[model samples]
Target chain A: MIILEDVHYTYDGIYTALQGISLQVDDGERLAVIGANGAGKTTMIKHMNGLLRPQEGRVILDGQDTKFMSVAEIAREVGLVFQNPDHQLFLDSVKKEVEFGLRNIGFTENEAEQRRQKTLASLGLEGLAERSPFTLSGGERKRVALASVLSTEPRFLALDEPTIGQDAHQKNRLAQMLAEMNKRGRTVVVVTHDIEFVIENFPRTVAMAEGQIIADGSTNMVLSNDEVIERCSLAPPQMTLAARAIRNVFPEVGQRLTLLSELEETIMGILGGA
Target chain B: MALIEFADFSFKYLGADSLALKRIKLIIDEGEYVVLTGPSGCGKTTFCRAINALVPQFHRGYVAGNVYTDGKNTRENEVATFASVAGLVFQNPENQLVTLDVEKEIAFGPENLGVAPAEIRRRVEELIELLDLEELREKHPHEMSGGEQQRVAIAATLALKPKVLVADEPTSNLDPKSAETILEIFAHLNKRGMAVVLVEHRLDLVARDASRIILMNKGRIVADGNPREILAMDLCEEIGVGVPKATQVYKRLRTRGVDLRNVPLTGVELAELVQEATSQ
Candidate 1:
């Protein structure tokens, strides 16, 4: 659905954030981009949604070069949710905030309202529909920002740290929402430092370091690589660590288990028979 | 001494209908490490603000009860007076930062208090080594990474030498390793006899370090106990707080009538427990 061919990006004509980056994201593929701060994760996502054009090389979305497409035109296909909610939220009320993006995309007032309600309801923000967004908490504001993008119904969705202030239940809800979106054949890309969230949800993973892609493979393959995780300043999720420790005692147990349910099942297979 | 005390306190924000905090009675002692957690808008932030007098003073809310910090009445003391008693590290490090360079930012707090240059130097040097921010000391605050900026914010807060540190979701924006480092720093500070009140939603990373866990919901304290006690209850999952992954596995095993020896909180502990059980 999206392809970045040897793309390079720089800020202020001096600081380079992406260097010779190349990757192909297939249609309806759920991928996670993981990295430390300044690893070009955010810069890379901006390229996907036409927020920033690469200084060198091409960012092609749906077989069209992004440089040739207007941001509004590209936004119809790719919706980008920034890391900070405050940067994106400007409207006073929650209902209006979600409606703004849909309205911008030339949706009728009736259609925009329908999407606004459905998107807010999907993220559990229906109760706060009338409240001022500024009065909401950090987590609530994050949901509103996400709703604004989801209301646009873009074919390719890119989220930067979508689970920043969310609690466990809220995180689970978001994961489920993303899964539903993926099921509907929309391409999803998440840029995050949230290793656990990625391990549990995203199937494909790419790790970046110092403005370049260092590792790209299955989520388990990339996250279990201690060297890559160390280079990215990320800690493996507790489930992976626990699975490794179990593997030490019982070598039959695998080392790549990333979810608690998977680890539990493995432990039961080994111990429950006893 | 009790570092902070709230007695039947309730507050309504200016122009708001409902009270943000309601009938909260709590006490945090000197040198205690407490983790306050809840779903968003559950009044955890309001409680943190109450500790440093940001509740009624700066926030301008209607108060119904007393809040005392460092044995001083919150209403009687100025927010500036709480500086040496309680220091706040907000969620966003960029929002809290003021000075240009890391060194100057760390020194900004102490300098404002008229601390001697030699004393400021000593404090700044101590925090730099404590946070391992020596490499970032000369870098501009705006130029550093999110982790580095948060570390600088911590160093700046430590420069105040407050008896209590109230950090509101300090690691929410950081990566796992950086988040662990922040918690380790808090644990170290707690050992030095500083009362630490951390408000965080990511309990899996910070739970073990806290001696006490105070769970709030809807402007009220719903649960208060040690880490093990709190995680053992079903309330953790009910309240949307994440119990440790190890704990979840243990809980699942116990539910299946497995005779687990201990409720392990970490991966190593869970592995060892499983090994012991299987061997038996």
Candidate 2:
């Protein structure tokens, strides 16, 4: 479990990035943190892996205080993938990049190689194993960065903008991979601007604005709230908007429909009744 | 003549074994808003680079056939010479922004083109107002948010008064709202008669706004047509282009025997169509 108690962080002693943020993530929880740029979503996620220690509060990771742990120490349990893949990827070969994380965390050479190969194949990066990370396309590089982090097999995985450069197909594959990771008892926390991905994948969501948590609950509930959606600069899923628009004709239809299947069922029901 | 034309174009990066873009023959006329889309590594970025002659001129790639911008063959002219004909906005705003502040960044293009100092100032001011970057005029572009920096980059690109603006996934780094804002700017610019060629994956947001949709995959132009017609195709979904959610819903409803006419691109349009279909 990860717990943040009234965490406050200020950058350069002036810009308050996080303001008294309090949250908790149970083991195996899938949580998404969303907001506009400069909303401090990244800052809050950095606390999970001790990348940024709160100035005024405490972050507890599995009953241990994160303040006492170095980034390398906390990384054993919590792996963080930065928003910019270039920031974390410095190795030559894609295979070596994944192995580096495993080796650094004290994994034996043979064990690291095993995990590295498995991680690469899982992310569909086996073909690019021998290629340089720098030469890959943006989406490919993102997966390489992810493979590097996933190779370590951390208990908690925090991804910052994992869906940014990915297309629908890559995004679908990533969603499936994250689900598999979560099922294996890894807690997943994602900070992203991709609301559609959030609605389709994550169950719980936290909406932030101006360095504070404005709303936190089920993804459907939080995304349906007009105030939160507007304040966070989030574009609601298209189906939700369409459901709301046709509410007068089919008042029983739920406006929180985020998936095509849900909307299809509602429309079919309405057509049958009509 | 077309604003941009590619004739049997195929290109391979200097050391790459296979072609990045294969036999892409297309014409983009003036004032057209074309949204190029496909899965990652589908050569959408390469297509955008070809418009501005970056593929062969700057990247030093093996090129076959011709790309003409503003009726001038790209192979014949310098990359700098095409700056005024086709402006390319890169994916990452940080890379394109060279000046310390927004005002200078906007002015850099016109200045490099040897435009008069007075004319450059006028263009900068006009672009600042046009892109709603007035508040950020004096601020450093690197210090601003991704959206703000992109706006500056677009403004700088516009300062050159290019006939067509080619943005390579300009909104990839932006939040949804900011992404919408950037697309809106492109739409607005297109309305003012400047051709806009945008490479994007978020087809749901742009399908309604674009005049034409070009879908690419495996270095080939798989589909190209009106947004409504192209997005309604199964190939769009099969090839990994994100068909608009509303369109997806419409298709699902159609599969279930819901009779609907005309593919809807937006939520409001879809709602109206459903209402019309069920009312009868």
Candidate 3:
């Protein structure tokens, strides 16, 4: 569980990235931070794992304040998978990258190697053990990054736009992987502008705009509010556009849906002469 | 009226033994949304560069074909003038953007073309509003997100108001929603009659609205059709082109003993199909 209390983050002593961000992410909750390009999403997540300390208030991780914790200590409790895989992955091989974190935390050579193999196999990167990390594609690099974090076995996982720029196949693979990881009871917080991913994957949603938590609730509830969506400079998902059209003509079907996934079924139910 | 025409166009980079493109004959009508896609290094980027004369000029390769743009042969045209009709936004926004501030960045193109100061100012302001970049005007390029920076790069391209805008993996730097906005902007431009070509592997976002889909493979346009038609081909999977969720669902249901060969193209259509099939 994580509790953010009046967290305000400013960089370079001038630009305020996040202002008064307060939220509680319960244990086992898959929370999504939805926003436009620069909606302070990264600033909020950086505070969690001590990448950036809050300039004001407190960021408490399972009752331990982040201010009192070192970044190395934070890494043990929360694994941060950044959008750019190049940042976290420093090893030559896919297998070693996964084991690097384990070895750095002072695990024995055997134990680190054991964790690396297991993590690689579990993520379907078993054959990539001998493969060079540099030779991999964008999607493969991201997977290697996730594999590295998962190997360390952190209690909480935070990702920044994990599916950016990936093809649909890659995106689906990521979605499936994240869903499987979430089902195992790891608290997953993803900061993403990928509306479709949010709609299909995360049941809960939080929208950030101009350094503020503008909306928070179910994915459907938070996304349907056009005022909040526009303020965030974000567009509605494909299904939401269709849902709104149906609502304009017949409000009945619109009331029962929030996500495009749910809307698709609801609309089909209506179209089938329900 | 075709703004760009390719006659059995084939190209191979300098010193390359194999052809990167082969026997490609095509015509892009002005203001059309044509998405060029395939697996990485499959000649998508190579073919895109050919539009703006990068193939033989910047690339210094042997091109054994004719490429005509606006009735002028691409090989014979000046690189600068051909650049005016076709603007290429590269895969990385950070690489494409060369300016410090948002306003100046947008006006960079018009200024380079020697537009009047007042015209440049007007164009920049209009672009800021059009692309919803008002608040970020004074901000530096590095201060923006990957998605914001991509938008800025795109807005700068629009300031030139080129007849054709080709972005090579632009959304590969953005989140899905921002990708959607970018695609929406592409659709808006196509509606306004600006010829557009996007080299993207994310077929789902452009699947519904794109007027034409050209599937490439090893420097060849293997398959060409509308969105649904291209997705329905088994070759799409083999060539590594992604299938939308609807197409995937449709393909799965067919194997699972459901008889919906008519795959829905978009999420909405898929939903409707599922709802109907289940209820019945």
lDDT of 3 by residue, B1-280 (tens): 6788888999877645567789889999887889888765467777887888887788777789888877778898877777678888875788788889998898888898898999888988888888889889788999887778888998998888789998887886565567777788888878888888998876767777788899987678898878777887888777567776567656655554566536677656765555555456
DockQ for candidate 2, please give it.
Answer: 0.74
With candidate 1 superimposed using the best TM-score fit, by how many Å does residue A168's alpha carbon deviate from the native? 1.2
Query: lDDT ranking from best to worst?
Result: 1, 2, 3
Clash pairs detected, candidate 2: none
lDDT of 3 by residue, A1-274 (tens): 8899999988898888899999999988888998776779988998888998999989998899988888988888888999788788887787778878888888899999998887777655676786667655455677789888877767799988777545555566667767777788888999877667788789999999889999999987888888878876665655555555556555565464554345545544554564
Once fitted onto the true fold, the runs of candidate 1 whose alpha carbons sit more than 4 angstroms away are none
The TM-score of the first chain in every model comes to 0.95, 0.95, 0.89
| Residue B263 error, candidate 1, Å | 1.9
Chain B TM, per prediction: 0.96, 0.98, 0.94
Q: What is each candidate's DockQ, to 2 decimals?
A: 0.74, 0.74, 0.16
Writing each residue's lDDT as its tens digit, candidate 1 over A1-274 gives 7999999998998888999999999999999999887899999999998899989999998888888899989988999999999999998899899988888889999999988888788787778888889877788999999999987868899999999888887888888888898899988999988878888789999999988999999997888898998988888788888988989878877646877899889888878765
Name the weakest run of 10 consecutive residues (lDDT summed) in model 2 chain B.
Answer: B134-143
- Model 3: CA > 4 A from native: A89-99, A107-136, A224-227, A243-254, A258-274, B1-31, B37-86, B102-139, B142-148, B158-163, B172-181, B191-193, B201-204, B216-222, B232-280
Tell me the whole-model lDDT of each prediction, alpha carbons only: 0.88, 0.88, 0.78
Least accurate 10 contiguous residues by lDDT in model 1 chain B: B11-20
Question: Could you tell me which 10 consecutive residues in candidate 3 chain B have the lowest summed lDDT?
Answer: B252-261
Q: Please say which candidate is ahead in DockQ: 1 or 3.
A: 1
**Pairs that collide, model 1:** none
